[model samples]
Target: MNLALFFDPLADEAPAWGSTTLGAHAARFVDTFPDWRSADLALIGLNEWRGSAAGQPAASAPDAVRQRFYQLQRGTGPCRLVDLGNLRNGLTLEDTYLRLREIVAALLEHNTVPVLLGGSHDLDIGQFLAYETLDRPVSLSCVDARVDMAEEAGAHAEDTHLRRLLMHEPNFLFNFGQLGHQQYLVPTSVLAALEKLHFETLRLGEIRADVRQAEPLLRQADLVSFDLTALRWPEFPGYLPASPFGLTAEEAAQLCWYAGHNDQLTSIGLYGYRPDHDLLGLGAATAATMLWYFVEGYYHRRNETDFTSRRFIRYAVGLPGNPAKLVFYKAKRTEKWWMEVESLADSSVRRIVPCSYQDYLRAAQGDLPNRWILTQALLG
Candidate 1:
């Protein structure tokens, strides 16, 4: 697939550089698009908002984000990054979706992480579809204020996009989680529906209390779709549905850092940015800083997937009344934790899932961790 056919060169003027702006350090595939075969991370921009919910705010979000993002200094280790410029919109919303899915699949096939600058949160349907075509079972983590599972309601497709993703045939979704959801913004029925599927949800207050608790959930995700509307309006007033109570800017950046550190995570869509509503471009700056932290975390990756590594310490605990023993692996290199759940059907197949110190503490107290039960049920 010739991706150049669907993209345009970056039109934002050259950002003023002090000693080291990221734009100056990074190689971009703009103007004359270059071969991305060797790139580790490829950035793509989507400027369309046709599928946004009613009262769609006017948005040229890609450029607005880029203007601020390019001005930041490069802080990560040497990285082969390329900006694929902005994706051209199709005549219809469905066509645009198809184009995006195809592009994302192509990038993934080449082992390049695709960081999407999105138009609307609904555009995540296309990102999710790419994984389906790749024939990979994926765990999706969505950071949004609302559940967005309502039956086709208003003009904004954001309200129905999650439903579309869940209902799509050949469903390859292994798990789904919603982070930073506000209780008042979500319907009771929507919560019930997700519970029926064994999906997970974390309320905004829960996250605000201890954002680190979100790491395990984010770690399990193969892809993440973040809506800028999840940020408080005072910190980031860049889109419709701007709320008085949502994640603070620092908390939002922390989540992005978590996403970047997730070894399983491959694709990420930063969506729901509307440049029209931004106050003195503060929203753009906040979004750019979040992206910067993501990149930083990406570089700090510990490559600690192998539990057998000498850096890992094994701990075994006996549970009271339960015949099965719980096993945990702690990575001394990164201080990360993982719990092993042997498949009931296939003893040889053991699943090591991300866990927290709290889970280990619970097991030591002869308690079966809820996460362990959830994993067992899913495997069964």
Candidate 2:
């Protein structure tokens, strides 16, 4: 299967906000990574946003301007951009969402993760709706320095996405790495509402201290979002609202690794990459690093599952808990297989345990394996 979908709207022609450059970053890194030589990843271009359909257009100035939004960074790979040239500005958000969703849905049909890079974070409001075109119980994971949830108790606010999401009611929402957020950006009441919903949070300091603390939370989500601005300015020099105490590209890469490493997650979007404001290709290169990290984790984790034999069931114990004290219990489903880990001796570490495959298959799926082959495992 094609591993990922690289979609760039080229909706905003301005050099800084263009997802095209970000897409190039992903392609370049994949080419540079030694492990990705055989990976079946494709960077496909998406239609231009032109700002007319409904979301905020680049200028929000006129519907008639054409060729207004275009941004592509330098890179080496098979990166394709769907150049719609210039789109009319008169289009409404509803119109944009409807058409854009159609395009996104087409990509998903091919088992692709529609990258949908660019235009505005407001584009995410539409991207969320596009996922509705597929299965239910859709979830979203957003990584940013601030809570885009600024719409409660006030008519107007920055990050209109908070209000937009409330209106759409996505199945669930998980937020990570929100540090140094100001009340003026999002009111305290809004944060309270989000907290009530069980949104996962990783403050800058907390995540920096240990990213493994967020493993379980990342696993529970279905779709994830990454706001490049979440990184500290020194680490990620390409975002518009860069922060001083944010995630470096490597740390952010680790977080993305966990998200893509999960089995439940189905879609991911990278938003808020501003190449125009970048210094000496730092932003583009970091964005590429983000994609490389995600794709690497994605394929690596996926290959860990073994499905060839019907009767056997297999699972790997993740590397977070201490393995020295983990004890496996005999599974009830099958006499030959072992069951769950009975004790976790240390909270500071995590360990992945691979048990009898046939037993889990029988218990979890009511079937037993005729043969078994362990494709890969992450129990270290």
Candidate 3:
């Protein structure tokens, strides 16, 4: 596919001499967009903002975020990155969505990760659609201040996009998780609906207490859609209906780092940025830094998944009344933990999922860990 037809090449002039600026190292499809099927990472900016209730203009966010992102220092490791420029908005919102879905699907087919710079939270629906186009069963994670499931009359797409995603036909979603959601801002009915589906929802308080607790949750996601409003106003002043409380800037970056390390994750969309509302580009800088850390983690990925490898240490503990033993595997290299879930219909078929050291301790105490129970429930 000729991606150039769908995108406008980045036309920003490189800043004056700097040894460490990303513009010096990262490859860009500026003058002429190239065939990016072989690149390790590809960035595409979504300029459409019609989904936002704030009434922001369409197709203006990609470059705003890029101005800050391209100025940051590049990492030491080899990063085969390409900037595909901003996507051109279609005549209708639906048309814009279809264009995004096609672009994301193509990137995933070539084993390239797509990092999307967004216009609003609703753009995530398109990102979710890409996974369906590939016919891959996936788990989705959202970082937002409120559940975007509100279905109201004359609401913007951001308000009801998740509703559509959840009800879409030919459902292939294996799991769904939400992080950093402010309880008071979300409706009780929405929370109840998610609970009925056995979906995971981590409140802001839970995440703030210990950020590492979010790693395993993020690891399960194949695609992550981060709503910038999840950050407190002091840190991200560009988000609408800005709240006084949300994730710290550091915590937001940490979550992105976790997403980058996951071998299962294929795409990430950073949404809810409005440059017009920003306080002297603070929001843009924060978003860019988060993107930097994500890319840094990506380059550091170990890509180790096989439990059968000799590099893994296996542990088995017998529960008091259970006939079968609970098994866990810890990687010798990264020291990450994974628990095995046997298929009830076929014992030979077992799936390994990310777990914590605490889960191992719980299993050793003859208690059924929640992670294990949840995985089993989802598998069923």
Candidate 4:
């Protein structure tokens, strides 16, 4: 595929980039588009915002983010990064989505993680659709201030995109989890509907209490879509319906770091940025820093997932339940946890899932961890 055909090259005037800055290391489109095949990560910008629920346009938001991102220093690693320039907006909103899906799918086939800088949260629909070609179920994690499951007639794309994704044909979604949702911003009925489906949800207070708890959830995800509206307005004021209370900028970066560290994660979308709403470009800087931390985490991955290797310590805890015992593995290198769960349909089939030390303690005390129960339920 001639991927260059789908993009419009960067148009911003070049600035003096420092020796150690990302602009110096990344392959960018100046005279010609960079070769994406050699990249470990590909940055794609979406310049379409017609689907936004706010009924606003942000055609230049992508470049606004790039201006800040290009100024940051590169992380410690072999920097094989490519800037594919901004995607050419199609004649219609759906056409743009199809173009995005094709580009993302192509990048995934080459084992290159696509980091999308989006105009609105709805653009994640393309990110989700890209996985359809894999023919395997995938887990998705979404971070937003409110659940975007509106089903009303004539609803805006941003407000109803999640509903469309969850109901997408072929149904390859294995698990869906959401974090940093402010309870007051969500409808009670919507929460009930999600709970009935056994989907995991963490309110803002739960995540704020301990950001580390969100790590395991992110680690399990194959793709993540983050809305900037999930951040507190004081720190990031670039999204409509801004709130005074949400995740701090540091907490947002931490979650992104965790997402990047996951070996299974193939794509991530940073959405809900509006340059018109920003003050002093702080919001763009915040998003750029989050991308920086994500890259840092990616380069620093420990690759400690080999449970059968000598680097792992295994433990079996006796239980009073029908399962009889719960088995866990702790990686000596990273001290990360994973627990085994037997499929109710076939006891011979087992799956190892990411967990935390607290879950191990709960199992040791003869109590089933909520994560264990949820996984088991999903398996059944």
**What are the per-residue Cα lDDT tens digits for candidate 2 across 43-135?**
322233332123333331111111121133423333332222222222555565565556556555655555444444555565667667676
> How accurate locally is residue 14 in candidate 3, as Cα lDDT from 0 to 100?
64
What root-mean-square deviation over C-alphas does model 2 reach? 12.3
User: Residue 128 of candidate 2: its Cα lDDT?
Assistant: 69
Regions more than 4 Å wrong, model 2: 1-90, 152-158, 169-186, 303-380
- The true-versus-predicted C-alpha distance at residue 129 of model 1, in Å, is 0.8
For model 3, what is the alpha-carbon lDDT of residue 170?
92
Candidate 4 vs. true structure, TM-score: 0.98
* CA-only RMSD, every prediction: 1.7, 12.3, 1.6, 1.2
Judged by whole-model lDDT over C-alpha atoms, candidate 4 comes out at 0.89
Give the top-scoring candidate (lDDT): 4
Spell out the clash pairs found in candidate 1: 52-156, 53-156, 54-156
Q: How much is the lDDT of residue 132 in candidate 1?
A: 77
Candidate 2 global CA lDDT score: 0.47
Per-model TM-score on C-alpha atoms:
0.95, 0.57, 0.96, 0.98
Candidate 1: where are CA atoms >4 Å away? 54-59, 152-155, 345-349
Candidate 4 per-residue lDDT over residues 113-176, each given as its tens digit: 9999967788999999999999998999999999999988888899888888888999999888
Off by over 4 Å in 4: 56-59
lDDT of 1 by residue, 204-319 (tens): 99999999888988998999999989999999988765678999999999999999988888889999888888869999999999988888778888888888879999999998
